[model samples]
Target: MREVVPWQDGPDGDADGPLTPSRDGAAKDIRAFDGALGPARAEGLLSALELLRADTARGAQLDFELLRRSQQHTLDAPQPPPFRSLQAFTKGGREHYGIDPTTRAHFDACQAESTTDGGRPLPLTVRAARACLDVCFFHPFDDGNARSAFLVLVFVLAREGVELDGVSLLRRITFQADDPQDALTLARYIDVHLAETRRSAASLGSQ
Candidate 1:
């Protein structure tokens, strides 16, 4: 959903540091893989992004169930797609994600934490990065778990009103769930792109 809200002005808004979605980094990543993944994946990612943006724009809480809509668009997800009960192995079967009766419950708990804590909350960057990794490591959906992870990252940032114009560092890269540095690396990646996006936007606004 491409939104068109009046500028946030007449208040203590930054004259040059206004966050703008100037370009769709998620869509760009999908397009780059369209030749291999096809148009359905593109449609799924784009539509899912719309859902995420719309919900965040209206202050809706983040929910994993909403992501099934996008997963269905990208791939043939079973009706209401139940969470996987079997173990999932990714990264050429090197990394294994096990599941039990409580897996779904754990996932929901993690998603609920994606929002602010309202008391000594973690920085938005860490929360967003961890949210992305949750989907990656949780391997929630039977398929498209990577795509789902990426979307969740975007959703987290969108909830905080941040969008990047480029996403080269965020996509198609594999991270280890057990690696201590992976989360830090991801947060750093998001921070780097975000800083550049703000810089580029400010430069454009000045011209």
Candidate 2:
């Protein structure tokens, strides 16, 4: 089984402020991780990401089924994993505290609200970041919740035609389920990566 770590900021510092490519070196880390993965597993992940990209490009909304399919591809396991029936925890002991009996119902409601633009209109990055946070805090799966959350974030951004070139900050960090500030911080992180990606693309286009 994959080792799980607490979802907390690294020693580098808090994730606030404008994240610069020079400061975070996330692009390198992402590239390194991709390179280190064996060919078969790497191809599997790429296929999964493409599936998500295609679905989002076609205007599919964020939903549990979509996530399930994404996870299925991500794991490449014999049978598709189901939503975790048992409670999950992170940070060593911080329980996800999701409603166990009605977890599926809660997930359904969350997905519905995520795709719709009701109430106060939130920016696309904020919505995408929040979706990732939800999956993190919900801890919906037994083993692959983190990967699923990342894919969900990617799908959210892809739907808007935005892709991040750097995903260093997005991974290996934990968030508090009830912390409003964490939500804002995640949104900021998304914006930082998005900005960097746009800048890189523009630079390449000019070259």
Point to the candidate with the largest lDDT.
Answer: 1
Name every residue pair that clashes in candidate 1: 1-50
The clash number for model 1 is 1
**How does each model score on TM-score?**
0.85, 0.77
lDDT, candidate 1, 16-114, per-residue tens: 333675677777777786536687667766777777778788887766677676566556445556678799999899889999888888888888887
Worst ten-residue run, lDDT, model 1?
1-10
Model 2: residue 171 alpha-carbon error in angstroms: 1.3
* Candidate 2 per-residue lDDT over residues 101-125, each given as its tens digit: 7878777677655553776545666
Scored against the true structure, residue 63 in model 1 reaches a CA lDDT of 64
Residue ranges of candidate 2 with Cα displaced over 4 Å: 1-31, 34-41
What TM-score would you give candidate 1 relative to the actual structure?
A: 0.85
